[model samples]
Target chain A: MEFLSERARQKLKSALLILSFFVLWEVACLVFKVSEIVLPRPTVILGALWQFFPGIRPHLIQTLYTTLVGFALGVGIGVVIGAVIGVSRVAYDTAYPLLVGFSSIPKVAVVPIFVLWFGAGTTPAILTSMVICIFPIVVNVATGLATTEPELEDVLKALGAKKLDILWNVSLPRAMPYFFASLKVAITLAFVGTVLSETVASNRGIGNLMMIASSNFNVPLVFAGLFLLAGLGVALYVIFSLIERRVAGWAMRKQDFAMG
Target chain B: MMAAKPDTFVPALPPSAPERARPLISLEGAGITYGRGANAVEALTPTDLDIDKGDFVALVGPSGCGKSTILKLVANLIRASRGHVFVGGREVGAERVGIGMAFQNPTMLPWLRIRDNIMLPLKIVEPFRSEFRAKRKTEFRDRAEALLEVVGLKGFGDKYPWQLSGGMLQRANLCRALIHDPALLLLDEPFGALDQFTREELWAILQQLWMDRKPTVILVTHDLREAAYLATRVCVMSARPGRIVADDAVPFARPRTLDMTFEPEFVALTQRLRGLIVDARTGKV
Candidate 1:
């Protein structure tokens, strides 16, 4: 009960901090008589958010769909590639430098290529998100498999475990915590990729809506779009975090006891 | 590699054991060298040793004396650089199907519950591997629970290894090694990490387990008192490029206790082995 109350107190404190920031912004804008085009007041942004709620829903859904689809593809391709590279030294040595080189190319720069190939719209946004998100999964999964303790492998081999059996029984379970950690980081990158592509060439998403609002000089509507994007990102991040806690709880629990 | 003459390198057979207790494992000038050419380093010198069926043999020596190399050779974890290793009266071939092993560290998979970890070998070896799915619902789980019970960890099978103390984890590790009913068990300092009291307790547990199953066991340890207390015979090895310098039988009777370690006969045996190890380490013998 004491721990529960302490957690509640921390949540309340964080809520107040956010509330104070908005209040301070509202007061500063009102005092300076700042132009709405230059810097909209918190009250104006809230009013615009209410007015644009129905208009924004479809755009929000479109952005969510593209990010999720791209994330799924990235995870599938990343796991297969990571497992192959991790199990064989030759594959790792040959492919790791190439992967690093590919990831280093700014994903936003690839958006134009994707648009040319897929002819603009949802396809480009999804492809751009996959390009941005795949690296973390590949890197984390490979690291997990490569770092299997030598003693554990020796024990399994002594028991007549083949390479495939070891992978299925030991390596895959060991990779879960790493895979879930990458999902948290990659989900954010997936959103970034979608928004960047939507701003460049897509016509019906939150990123496009923000661009249209800015061009029309409706800064309040642009702020509303930014707020909605943040909410979506936070919501998706929370979902992934919950799944991580469920699947990889063993890794976290193992650290509590000293080795003795 | 130079050839070691067969007549000079043969290990002595156990005179006290029954005549039918034939040698189950033998190393005929078996040795290991790491790397190649100029960088090559001999880890174990060409040496011969024999262990009889149902015998508990312990290898004791100074650190880095290649005691573990012998255990690895038997398990086929690493191939010999020269000569031959035979187990169960045949050359130990490509697949080492019925061998069990445990290391100094418990080495339990942190992701698995103790029950699943103990059942892991069954998912790999022999007829059990093929029947694992059907037996998982009945026999496989029963065997795991029974082994856990033998190690005094009856209800803890549902827990992960990390939840246990180091001694408990080591006990669980022993269960995992023995779960598959392997023909031979290799232990590389299995109790080397425990506190003195825990070590003694586990010694009793291991002694009882060995008495019950009677599997051919080769234990590699740095603890001389441990070697004297548990083994039917103890072999002391020389430093680096290691070979056995002393092979002495422990003439004590079965169902031994911690009390036996305090006996004058046991003390004399430990002191003798200790002096031999000291000499071996200092190159005196």
Candidate 2:
């Protein structure tokens, strides 16, 4: 095994940071002397985490599938539609006002409507996830595409480029930095959309389990579900970030690494 | 003599040969007015002008004096309130495939490598693009490399626009403009942003490139010395709502050097142009 000096040091530093947070948390729990019913101690939460993972393995897989599929569809449609509207003036004028109007309406307010229309299943969750996740991509990508430098546009025109070539080569690549930023927002929204869908409409996914645990005051499990949801959100975020890293390798050039 | 208005710009440049060769491009009775009614300001009055095949011309004038407007009119970026334009001997219309352009700012696409950025037009503009992926990719690349080498960007194909120095970007910008070898080359102060050293370097580079390519060129700039250095003919204009006041030929030798500006003949031409510009500023022309 090749053990690099800097990598080992970074690993040690991160581990220490995480350990420090846990220690601080444990100390605060003991000093407050709170009952297990609210804000369990570090050991209690860690134990609960171990038990919950294997027990809800099937539900975990189900939630993962719905979240991924919905995210894919939302991003796919958002990018294509956003790019279309971004490049065309009439389309931008006609559709942009409508999109902005729709986006202003709260996404969660439509959760029940989706359940009524699609019923309580993966469909509702996916549809809800897509709704929550798609708008930011559209807005961000469109904004990026619309705001491309006019001089560059002139260059393309002089070169004899058609609309499609301009969009594909000039406008689209320029929009990607914006697109990746929106993807981060989309990842968090995907989790919120999926969980909200499950909480409101589904009976089999993590959302339903949380609701059942809370209504019965199975306090530990409910806290566990909350923790689990946060973890799932982090996992999804990490995945989106990885995809961003893999595909948009060019963004590394923008790494001016701000200190403040 | 038939009554002719000085305010009018002719629709076609007269045939230089006076017989056989029609101008590759010409403007007849061209006028541009911005706004309407009380607010209207005429940027350029109706004026006649012609550009023969392979002519290298410059438009020199005060700021916002419609030197650029002339370029926009020719590029069909905008239209004149009156007059007809003919490019390649045909009336300017929707099927124009014969124009290349460069701007004051070196506006290369930032995301694309320099080579690909230059290749963008070929990806879209046809004849080339339609046959791009198949028969002409190698040919297009070789052409791009050759053009790059001409502009001193031979080894920078894979680098992005951001990585290039300003002079390099401008050189790349100039090459990109002429890559397709259009019948007309419209440059709007293409070196207006560079430092003195870089600008003079590009000046010679542009002169040589023009010599090599020999397209009909109309460059717009506020730099009188620049116009004197590179152009075969210099057209001066009046202030905003601009109009051409003088269109004087340089009558200097070919392949001119920057050192030529110190010579008596070049100094005389510059002084004469400066006097006209002073007259223009005073509304005395």
Candidate 3:
């Protein structure tokens, strides 16, 4: 109800921006008489989106399932490997060079290899996402775990804590803020990785649908796909941010106080 | 140097009677060096100490004088370069237990609730560990609550560490250390962060905790009065490559209150330790 409320203002501004964009696009099309195949107006895009909402069922499900599989597998593997590497000096030392190299090589370059290994189906897409979505968690958690302060460690030790006990208590809790810091980045990458991998190889997902729409010069469908991807990204990021806010309450409070 | 007084450097420890219960911890010919040869800095050189059961010992010296190193040696948190550390008459070869420690900064786990932070040791240390989540666990909670009560933090159990003031956090920090009822409580200047009044207030709380718990305490501090008031014996060290210079015992007795700070005996002993630190400062020790 309040005029200056942040959420209301934000929503109002976004609605205005979208409205103006559509208006400009319509005017540009009218003035130039741009072919609909080349550049569709907002109304056409909306119509395509309406059609898409119904026809996208089977493909959307397939794409989403494959994407999520890749994302989850990547996260699972990344966390376990990262924790081991993060905690153990010898393990980290042995793995560091290889991980560094793996991190450097662009994940996009591996699509063909994954395709050859797993075939041009959901497997390849999932594999690509798995490869692409893991690094941030590994890097972030490892960094967080390694750099816990010595004095805290000593206190835990003096309290007669077993090594595992200290790890569970001080090191793990201390690493939480850093974990969430990286998780926010990691989750978004997972989503993107899935979508991109699907785009390259998927048959039923939004990505494949986009490719189909683009090649056929169905501009509204392409715009529809783009808009959906953007929405997904925003939604996922907002969800992760909420989780971060809860898990890292202390860090947020200090930041908020410091900002004020 | 003659042993100054009975109540000064030794507490009335119930377990210390009859059997010569070997000192809670001992440092024998301890030496620590950083680096080697021409570049080596010998941080501590052949230091010896017998911190008695329930005696509050203060290791005070100028910066870089290895005051912290002495506490480390006693805790067995680090190895001595050339000597041995003993706790409860055995080599610190993994059987040593019941050592609670605190540092200058309040190192509470930022994510955990204050109750969880205090209950950490119970969840870690043996006897308490296996039975923690099992047996009612009310005992551990009561123990934490009692310690918090003693530290004047009765209702702050659920609040996170960040939500508390520095003084309150440090009190909770010390409580977490003492929760396991360790025989040797090692405090490295626990009140160094609080204001003057707050620091003095914490000293009284610390004294009462030491009095009630009767743990062998090694408090590393730069404050001479803190050393005098809280410690049974104040061990002064020389600068840089440090060794004990003045090992003076206080003259005051138990049931010591804030009023004792105004007494002549307290003043004289405070002045005496002050002179020893100055003696250490001038290389006069």
**TM-scores of all candidate predictions against the true structure:** 0.92, 0.88, 0.88
Question: lDDT for every model?
Answer: 0.88, 0.79, 0.79
TM-score of chain A of 2: 0.87
* Candidate 2 Cα lDDT to native: 0.79
Query: Which candidate number maximizes lDDT?
Result: 1
Cα lDDT for residue A197, candidate 2: 86
Model 3 chain A worst lDDT window (10 residues): A251-260
- Runs of candidate 2 with Cα error greater than 4 angstroms are A1-19, A251-260, B1-18, B94-97, B135-137
Ranking, lDDT, top scorer first: 1, 2, 3
TM-score of 3: 0.88
- What is candidate 1's TM-score for chain A? 0.92
User: Relative to the unseen true structure, what is the C-alpha lDDT of residue A148 in candidate 3, on a scale of 0 to 100?
Assistant: 76
On TM-score, who's better, 2 or 3? 2
lDDT of 1 by residue, A1-260 (tens): 67568868999999999999999999999999999999998789889999988998899999999999999999899988898888888989998999999999998789999988988899999988897888999999998888788888999888877899989888988999999989989999999999999999999999999999999999999998888888888898999877777777777744322221
Least lDDT summed over 10 consecutive residues: which range in candidate 3 chain B?
B1-10
Score residue A57 of candidate 1 by CA lDDT. Answer: 88
Between the candidate structures 2 and 3, which one is better when assessed by DockQ? Answer: 3
Kindly indicate the candidate among 1 and 2 with the higher DockQ. Answer: 1
